[model samples]
Target: MHFLQHLPHFIGLERLDASEIRLTQSVITTLCGLPALRELCLYMPSALARSEGRPFPNVHRLELLDGFPFPTTHDIVAFCNKFPNLRALASSAGYGGLLRDLTRAEESSIFPVLQEYTGTLRNLHIFARRSTLTHITLVDGFLFSRLVAELQGVAALPNITFLSLALITSESSWFDGAQIETLFTLFPNLTELQLTFMPTEPDPQILTWQINGSLDALLSLLPSTLRSISLKLDLSDYHDTRDPDLEDDFSLLFDYPHFPSLRAELMAKCPALTYILFDGYHFLFLWWKTSTSSVWEATADYYADARGPSGAT
Candidate 1:
């Protein structure tokens, strides 16, 4: 009476119906013996059944969870040796360790064998302990930059049309203009870009002058092949005025110049920019006349009836 031998008695009866059956090695041995099982998954090591010199040949889509004790890369390599046709692998481990465990000899080895992978590689998610690190380490630390390099390193496959970067505003210095330029260069076919970041209230006067400049710089970094862009900035910080730098930040967030520059830049370079969502406001209809660009048009048209000083409106 071994532990795995008693599994089938505890199997599905009138009371037991669950799609995802999570079990350890002892339980799996019993579950696999059930001919009624359709799609089986082993969260434990693939080698568990093999240790007994038996194989569960029916389980089509296998997922290896993080419960295995394989510390080195070879353990993963040995595991994948059994499940040769595994289609997708999803893991929360570091990319460097994952890649080593994956046992991919080269770029082709990975894409061809795995076919479609949805997780970051082992080395892509590394971070520096301290604030002061060199450019190479900084570049390595950012996942998107590493992704760009990996995509470039790999041989031809289907073109990647869109790339989304999960950005932290605190990490903005890591993604300077040079890094952005390198990204566009690496992924020439990329047309859509999504950037998510925590917001900072730019200086009203400074933003009045620099917003468009920054927009222009960003636009210039992108390739001509790009047609659409979606940029998101988290404004939760914009509402907070406690910091010394952001003492008067609320004023900057609502400042007239900020919107004007944003409007002008959107009108100019992103002409094909079919869509734009700013803050929480959705600009569904944008009517920019080609006859003459008037900055005061919105001010006059909207505030014409208001009782205020002539210049106030």
Candidate 2:
């Protein structure tokens, strides 16, 4: 028992995954014994502040796992202080639900040097105004009004090179695809992109999205620096429903008759785009070249994939 308690002091522990450990004061004291520790993963790390100890100076990468509620404003400050040199923050669970109460100074200082973040769009919107982040992945999906309205005083971040996010398909908002174009403009240097779609309502009798116009107006604005694009539909909410595949329709947008020509034209205009993928509905599109010119091609995975999208279920 004693050896187990003093185990950290004997070895040169450089990385730790304490996410499953019930972190206690003794556990924290054990952490202080490792000076070479540079990477860490923790779960619901609110107790770090209460344990009086010198901070880890070299820790730069932090991965926060979700089991309990997120650290509150009370613990957020001191918890972040433990890793003053942190540069990347990742969380599988959505982030920044209760952290909206932080003061301007605290918000600015939180992840002050962060260059990469993977979490919810809500938190990104909360911190984007003050962040210089170069890579972002928002799993919770984009909320347009919530992102732009709060950034009235902030300029678009050009340093970002990679971005992946999900957007809910709401006919009223996403019909023209203007929102996505605006998003591309925010990160001018973005090289790789992936966009997933989700239904706005959880279990509607029949879910449908009929874009009123062609998506070309938005595709025309694809960043010249962008090299790849991916679009997906998440039907996880319909796993147990009756006729799930046929009921949740997104036809007018994805199965537009002219999309093949549109893609060829768009790729010609952008020149830098090497791949355009439609991952949802089992559809796939590729960019290839002919003897004299370049063109776009479509590949399918199954019989359903080859069929055109349905306007409505």
Best by lDDT: 2
Going through the candidates in the order shown, the clash numbers are 5, 0
* Over 4 Å off, model 2: 1-14, 32-36, 70-72, 92-97, 201-214, 239-266, 286-298, 303-313
> Which runs in model 1 stand beyond 4 Å of their true positions?
1-21, 24-69, 79-90, 95-117, 121-158, 168-176, 198-212, 224-228, 234-313
Q: What lDDT does each candidate get?
A: 0.41, 0.65
TM-scores for candidates 1 onward, in order: 0.49, 0.76
On a 0 to 100 scale, what is the lDDT of residue 26 in model 2?
72
Worst 10 residues of 2 by lDDT: 203-212
Winning candidate number (TM-score): 2
* RMSD, one per candidate, in order: 11.5, 6.4
Candidate 1 structure quality by residue, lDDT tens digits, 1-313? 4534565875442122222444456654555455444343444563453344334433334444445555545545445444444443444434244453332353223212332233344432221111111111111124455555544554322244555554433323434566566666645555556554443434444443343344556756665444456554344454444465443443335333244566556546545444333332111112223223222222221223322322212
